[model samples]
Target: MRLQPRFRRPGGPWQASDAVLAIPLGLIVAILIADILTPPNLPLGPLLIVAPTMTAWFAGPLLTGAVGAIAVAAQVGAGVALGILDMAFLAQVLALVAVAVLVTGLCYLRTRHIQELAQVRTVSEVAQRAVLRPLPHRIGPLQVASAYLAAEENALIGGDLYAAVRTPSGTRLIIGDVMGKGLTAIGDAALLLGAFREAAHRRAELPELMAHLEQSVCVNLAQPAEGGEAGEGFITAAVLDVPDKSPKVQMVTCGHPPPLILHARQVAALPAARPAPPLGLCEMFSPEYFVDTFALQAGDLLLLYTDGVIEARNSHGAFYPLTERVARWPQISPPELVDRLCVDLLEHVGGRLTDDAAVIAIQRTQDAA
Candidate 1:
């Protein structure tokens, strides 16, 4: 029987932890019951702390805050009614309320801010979907995975791009970086992707398809900025073609950073034979863009990323250790590894990134049984 391969969807909504909420709810009920049984002399500090913390887990930050406030109020009322309301008890209650109020307020603000963040993410995602969108996990004989990080504080749009499509010859891939960041960068990325997608499918030669993309950029820059491609900024990119399912990958670069090859716990940049100036900067001269070949082995992983990831600066303004970090990741499924890397990378930056960054990991899977 022939087996149909299942593909994984990339870049979707973050699933809230049901356990994080459930545990808190259970703890709240248990603590309240214990409070009822033990009455006045109960040590409820742990319960109180857990109450506010639980609020954040279950009902989200807003609901968590409200729950925390209610818990604090209940504790105060119970203490007073049970005759445990001495001066010392009053100080403790005051302290509990103060802490609870502060925590809940912060959670509330975070929740509200997250809502606004969701809106921006939705816009950025839609902007990308209409332009670049997601790629199929498998194309003919190839298996693929991709990750994108928009370096705009909490915004989700970036100038980095990658695309793969199977054609008459074989599977062709385009990994490129548009100059600058923000909406304008997105415009340049979109233009390059649109032209490459159309031209790659129709044009017989790789050079012609690349030429078409450069032409598209020129035209996009010529028009009254649609979707924010202004000032005729250029983009650096690379295109790959693996014709006839050969073990060699033919590639052309446009002043972009070189991609890294990961094999058997070792990661190294693919050596370039010759490179060319970035797209949109071709008006002054006709640059000689050379096409080089690299050997591709099954089970090997190729990492194509824009400058945002490697160049991400920490508090000390130090660049992220990409080679060390990726090497540290366990060789596992694409999404799991990428998720871990994302956490590790963000933690290094103390939370979020400052520039647009994208990472595309393409792994060659052995032919399945």
Candidate 2:
């Protein structure tokens, strides 16, 4: 399903309270202006000092200072012209104007900083879209949900990857682990996914589809050295083919973890009936390497994940316990289960991780209209 930026209230160390200051600032400005027109018995020029502060409280310091400077200059010029205000008062008004301008200048600087932050966020959001496209809601009637996290503190993309699509033959799905991290791994991941989509539709059988992927990578690996190509890079992927209304799903393991099966709210590991060696290797498969089959049921869910989820090591170096963690979450809809699993995994790692992660969950939905 499609994802959105998780919304949370803006949080930070500094927050100026405008509520308590708004009314008082407004009333003070009102009183100062009244004194200007209706001269009071007592000189109220000193009270005009707070006029600029009202702008800071409501519109932020930058606009506040501008208003303050204008009010102070007008009051000073008028008072001196009328001969009612003394030299001391004129000096006081100039000082107040200078202070207001200084405060507003600081506000202007902060506003520029905030704009820079917004620009950075926009760039991040675009990169995320280019990296992880929005997931489809239903792939051949299997309700799907996914969660992806980049390794770095503020990263929005990563090396771990997954994709699912429905074809005439069956529903094609893949989950893979790129060897390393950073932009290089992400590029390889993109190539892998691009090949998988086109090849999954072209190949006649599971092994053939796997071969198509290997060949795509091999072609790149064999490119001229000047092309910035690496000869031995490879990814471990698990490819699945599930037909419409079928009770069993055919799959091949290319050095990927076994998919978890969820039925009636219980989770179990689906045995790889006959696992195949990972793609991109010559003579890597033995006679035993063949397509595995999983007997599925209505409402059954299959989960494919990258090593990031399982290999997440804590400060103590103990790997994350994924199987055990899911065992505790009572069965729910595919989306809900996906959500809870993500939460549980994040909690396991203390809300942060050093490696990228990806999770793909598919549950058979009631027949579509």
Measured with C-alpha atoms, the lDDT of residue 259 in candidate 1 is 83
Winner by TM-score: 2
Query: Residue 270 in model 1: shift from native, Å?
Result: 0.9
Per-residue lDDT of 78-179 in model 2, one digit per residue for the tens? 576556666676676777777777767766666556667768979987976676676787777778898887776566667777887668856888888877
Q: Which pairs clash in model 2?
A: none
Q: Tens digit of lDDT per residue, candidate 1, span 157-216?
A: 678888887788688888888878777787778778878887888877767777888778
Which 10-residue window of candidate 1 scores lowest in summed lDDT?
Answer: 1-10
For model 1, the superposed segments whose C-alpha errors exceed 4 Å read 1-124, 224-230, 330-333, 367-369
Best by lDDT: 1
lDDT score of residue 38 within candidate 1: 81
Computed on alpha carbons, the lDDT of every model, listed in order, comes to: 0.72, 0.71
